[model samples]
Target: MSIDAIIMGIAFICIHLFANDLLPSGRIQRLKWFSFSGGLAVSYVFVYVLPTLHKEQITVKKYSDYLTMESELYFVGLIGLLIFYGIQKVVRKAQKEGENKKARTLFWMQILFFGLYNALVSYTVISHEVLGIQAVFYGLAVGMHFTAVAHDLWREYEDIYNRVGRYVLAAGILMGWIFGVNVSLPPVTETIIFAFISGAMILNVLKYELPPDEEAHFPTFAIGVISYTSITMSLKFFFQW
Candidate 1:
């Protein structure tokens, strides 16, 4: 990685680590800003990431004769969503079961899943060839998404999250960045990883951010969705990506 990319990667990690603390607890839960951020993230995933994944899927199909299905990328994404959903279900069940064997097992499950998620995100951010204005936009969307993720973690784990979970996430990001800077995965492998992350992003935003229980501000969320989607679509059209 270039020095510029490495600096940007560190900056992104810092934003992910600290952005949640910048908002007050009540605002983090109830603010329209969170809705706007959620909208921005979800829109970016649908508008930019999914299309790129589709293109990658075509390329992967063209190169690899061993593949039997054309929709392998989408299936990989489905697996990602299902895996995370299963983890979430287990954790919720454990939480309801109180301080028992299942709860402890599921608590660690949540921690491990999110740690790996953060590491995957960090690795993708550093290793992807996104640059210039596109990189900035991608970083902004992901940073907002990270803010939502951090808030969810804090709400779910309370003092445990404050004491230890945040540090684990930060370490995950750093470790992922270190690996991304030093090593590179093959093209097909990278494509599969990106597809999986895209699916997880879709699941995370829809499940956590857009739920009816969330105090989402519709006007702000609509504004964010329309604005970011318009910008990204325009860029894609102009650049013919």
Candidate 2:
């Protein structure tokens, strides 16, 4: 095994061990351990071991190939950290006695975000980038995955477990792709799809414009305009030579 593979294994073990301690010590929670171990094992195989074996099997290979996998795994691990920490914070907050309603709402919001993101991933992988603004679309897709996973976990733990899962999945996808997997299309297009779906859902759920005015019919048009302008500027800069 390469240094990267060893590093990934250590990282996964550390993260899962830390996660085991992070949750409250109540309900028959063997499932939590089971899930964490299972996920870690699967991730190890697909993201690390298999890819390493694939390259080793090849007759000729470039050093860049190995480096690319290393870089991707590094970022993927970082993404997992982001997801794990975010969920941990939320879970701690939700456990507080007075924050029940707020906790539930936040959890649901996360689910909605994941739902939209994963849907976008499914869509983009099938539909190649037509407009060419890949970042926006992929960002949106990731956002939706956050929503979907959050929703699933909300239904199960009502504790934002989905948020953690979404982060891991997104990180996995990002890193896996960076190394040479074709499981996903470009990120920009995914983000764009997420943007559209999330924008629509926000108004319906919030029952008013974003920035949340009291008036039910208040216009969030300005916010939308500014956001669009910013995206456009970013695309121009990114695509510019």
Candidate 3:
């Protein structure tokens, strides 16, 4: 297919996937603002430029706008798509397989990671304007948790092994900088520490004896909330101005 078609296709799929995650359980909802924003951001380019191509109706200004729109669509859409697929695949697999003992362990582990990931993203977005050089610290914090988990599980999930491995490596580097003797901890350090500890404590719930159905409700809500808030903020940032 043409590059334009490929971009539009990916953008559509990603926007749909992310928007679906935000839907209320068992309800069908139309596209959210983020999805529309992403759709326009992606499809508008081809809508505007492709018609003008063979008719000798194209202009440089039109081409420039198309390129700009295409770039943003691809970039933001790619990120949203990755997060959507990552969460969807894991959750679906757990659901289909009926959540065996090990699967349950891994499932809750993923939830713990999800919580930490949310807090990390929240911090990064909030501090982006103020932290300047310190933003890397937030990244490092996220990386470290990702690394520890990935390194421990890479052998099982070979498909994402490389991605997980890379996160682990970055996490190590970030941890070194954060805790290194010379570099003092930043202001967010205390809060992040508490969050990490809380995540760990919450994760221990996985160890307790419980039926699969009984354990599912809590995490379903947790993930749903995370999905809603993340998509909401992303919508505001990308479209609402």
The top-ranked prediction according to TM-score is: 1
lDDT of each: 0.79, 0.38, 0.35
- The count of residue-pair clashes in candidate 1 stands at 0
Task: Give the lDDT ranking, best first.
Answer: 1, 2, 3
lDDT of 1: 0.79
**Worst lDDT 10-window in candidate 3:** 202-211
> Against the true structure, candidate 3 has what lDDT?
0.35
| Per-residue lDDT over 156-220 for candidate 1, one digit per residue giving the tens place of the 0 to 100 score | 76666777777777777888888887889988888888888888889888888763545778888
Clashing pairs in 3: 147-168
Which regions of candidate 1 deviate over 4 angstroms?
24-30, 211-214
- Rank by TM-score, descending? 1, 2, 3
What TM-score against the true fold does each predicted structure earn? 0.91, 0.30, 0.25
Highest-scoring model, lDDT: 1
- Candidate 3 lDDT by residue in tens digits, 1-241: 2333223223322322232233334422221322222222222122221222222222222534444332332333345335534653675587578776655556545544543443343332332232322233223223222322332343344434343433433343333323332344453343333333333322322221111342234343344335544543464467542
Q: lDDT, candidate 1, residue 54?
A: 84
For every candidate structure, what is the RMSD over all alpha carbons to the true structure, in angstroms?
A: 2.1, 18.0, 18.0
Model 3 per-residue lDDT at 14: 33
Candidate 2 on 155-217: residue-level lDDT in tens?
A: 445334534644543444344333322455344333334334333333222221122233112
lDDT of 2: 0.38
